[model samples]
Target: MTNSRGGKRERLASAAARVLHEQGVEKTTLADIARAADVPVGNVYYYFKTKDQLVEAAIDAQDSDLRTMIEALEAMPDPRERLKTMVGGWVDQRDLAARYGCPTGTLAAELDKRADGLDERIGAVIRTFLDWMERQFKEMGRDDARELAVALLAAYQGISVLTNALRDPELMVMEGRRLTAWLDTL
Candidate 1:
């Protein structure tokens, strides 16, 4: 019973993440999340007392996924390759980015406009990626590693915005190629 209850909670959080990504925080509701998770609407309250709590759970899930992805890249000995692989991974999600923008960036933007305290929580996703990229650059022995990491993150975020605005998934792929080429030159 405990395992089943935990699974339901996990399912709810995952559904909340997807719904929030598609609808933003303002439009997403507990009922929407419950429906997405195939859980009874009343049961949502059992897992999360409020929308903010569910949002926090979603953010935690995203952070965990990001850490896992970065850990995979860390196995590579060459920092440049690790960075390139990361760009490729983003490119692979071009279709999704075009449809919903970046999950973390879009959520952060919405929460930021609301003046809610959740901005810091959502921003942690970007910060984690930035920190990982900075470490990669530092591993490559670049003195300007922090700047490079910021530039790389900025470029990706800009690409995500453009992809969503223009409804052009190809743009992400093209930008990914350009970023890879630029990284090669560094």
Candidate 2:
């Protein structure tokens, strides 16, 4: 039901996103999501039959947010500026990244061991960014655009790991600046 908080379904999806980002798939329960969303735990079953369905809702929410951000980033005509700005955006999330690590990276790492196709579902979140970064590199006339894309994400995820391990948001900012400079050379 819609109220001052918006649709319950939407709130649940948002809660799933936040909880999943902070807590990982295995650690996060439907009850946890329901509580975070301020909905009755039983009501969750009315909207999503299973936890996987709820996780999928969270993935959908991430995809939608990513699309909106990507769309805005695409408005920049220059590919290099687009990428640099993207790094700056990551820098903006230094605190969160430092605290929880890269949300997509952590999710992928946790889901990777699972037998179900959820791994690939969460993986597409990274792949989506990879594809966009690849396009940007391609526009820069790089012969190995895909390779650069992989390298870029790899560096970001690596930095995120270090950021969390060291409990230093400044590390991400430092790496973000370095990545932006590296992008300039590409």
* Candidate 2: stretches off by over 4 Å: 1-6
Per-residue lDDT over 1-186 for candidate 1, one digit per residue giving the tens place of the 0 to 100 score: 999999999999999899999999989999999999999999999989999999998998889889999989989889999999999999999999999999988998988886677888888788988999998899888999999999999999999999999999999999999999999998
Top candidate on lDDT is 1
Q: Which model scores highest in TM-score?
A: 1
Write one digit per residue (lDDT tens) for candidate 2, span 1-186. Answer: 246344888899999989999998989999999999999999999889999999889988888888899999999999999999989999999999888998778878887898698888988887898999999999999999999999998999999999998999999989988998899787
Clash pairs (backbone) in predicted model 1:
none
What's model 1's lDDT at 110? Answer: 89
How many residue pairs of model 2 clash at the backbone? Answer: 0
For candidate 2, report its TM-score: 0.93
lDDT of 2: 0.90
